[model samples]
Target: MSEGLSTRILDHIVHLSPPGTLEDSADAFRKLGFTVTPGGTHADGQTANALIIFADGTYLELLHFTHAPPASTAHPWAHKPPGWIDYAFLGNAGTPSVADTINRRAAADGSGVRYAPEVRGGRTRADDGRVLEWLITAPAPSEGNGTRASARGRLPFFCGDVTPREWRVPLEPRSNAEHASKARGVAYVKLLVLPSELDAYAKELTSVLGVSPAASSASQVVWELERQPSDSQPYQAPTLVLNAAEEYEEEIYVRERGAGIYELGVAVEDAGKAGVAYTPYGRVVWQAIGSR
Candidate 1:
């Protein structure tokens, strides 16, 4: 495997809800046995969120618009209907930024991958009046001026924090990481791509992750993640799975939301609680994978 980008650690996955449903969404997740933490409004003031943090440091961000939708169709969340909208990889602002590193690798390999310039973003904590900031870099349109790629959510965006990451993702009070449903952390994320686009997306993801797929077939590609060790229990490394949207449900999903993350798999401990659950925000497919 190529030494992937240093910033490839899974950060968090975003679950978007309809306008003004932040609190409702949070409450719904709590009922599902998660511990939801209050996340204040974004610097933009139009969005706010709550977080369901996991033992392994990855989290589920339950978010919603605070007011009317932005008028611009170019906005990431503009016209986006509630569901799993995006996911992020931890990143940094350094000599060779995450975006620069990935783009450089793509250039070297003749893969035309381009991430937009990093944008500054932050939010205040609702529990405490603290401010946290970060830089975001997402896939951008390739002008065809390059070697050969283009797409979105099929790959993760990068989020590099300006403030202490702990302040932004507090893992203290161990109970916060303990869910009644026994979910330990993200197990895998599955994206549904049009059959014709699978090959291109596989290349796009390989370029972004800086590593080749651990397993692949004509219909699916899998990249196994090396997870951060948990304090309470050892975890099986997570996996990122991309496959063609040929099933009826998958086809419908692509028609409705295009190619993007449609489901999340979380590692859980209780067999009784192991199953699938659909929420207004997103679909969760969990399993009873005991500690390693």
Candidate 2:
């Protein structure tokens, strides 16, 4: 467990589009009032994601396959792991031993999910010779009941080494930008419920994200943005909840394949204005969800 990555809080979450094609979904996101950036092929050469920037260092990444099916040998996350998505937390110099610390914390929480966290980090130099560093994976099980961090694990904690001061720059884009998405930034995200696992899922998230779960009525839990760390003024790590009832099985299955939303949120400045762009999917409104 090395220190030096950022884990300030969740800066963003990711949604993996279907493998090999996301133009439609990308367009859909664009219509949702976001400035969608281009994505490139992964190092393992399996998928890609268009990123949505927030004023905060955090952003939302929509990943999907970009070419021929990736060989099984590619990175598990890049192979397009199953689930609605993945999320990125802040990491910086203060977060050394992040992998180890979180694993230990989880186990101490007494949820009984045991596993150790592994790392896939490397160092590369910037043009000026400064080393750009990054590392990620689930918190080690020792920190969280010794559970293994597997591909598509629910609410896996993301620890970062980057400090709040150093994140003023924009994230790198994977592809090109279209004019339509220029004004876009993350407004917030909504997690449609995983009710069957709501309590357990919320508990896991609290451990990983360092935030308590919100109470629910009708299985719909909404997290309101409190501190807008970014220019968009959206809360950091703001999450939305939907009823994940067995009653809604078909809808969940259609969206998740077999699982539920790894995470869900949105990018917009004015929910009212953005509603027009979102009408095709469902009713759009600046629905008020209280702060936690």
Instruction: Give model 2's TM-score versus the native structure.
Output: 0.64
**What would the per-residue lDDT of candidate 2 be over residues 200-265, giving only the tens digit for each residue?**
655555555434546666456544333334444434445445355545544555355433342343
Cα misplacement distance, residue 282 of candidate 1 (Å): 1.6
Runs in model 1 with CA error above 4 Å?
1-5, 143-152, 229-233, 290-292
* 45-72: candidate 1 lDDT, tens digit per residue: 8889899999888888888888778586
**lDDT score of residue 254 within candidate 2:** 32
TM-score of each: 0.91, 0.64
Q: What is the C-alpha RMSD of each candidate to the true structure, in Å?
A: 3.0, 6.3
For model 2, state the Cα shift of residue 122 in Å.
7.2
Model 1, position 202, has a per-residue lDDT of: 83
lDDT of 1: 0.81
lDDT against the true structure, per candidate, is 0.81, 0.46
Q: Count the backbone clashes (under 3 Å) in each candidate.
A: 0, 63
By summed lDDT, the worst window of 10 consecutive residues in model 2 runs over: 279-288
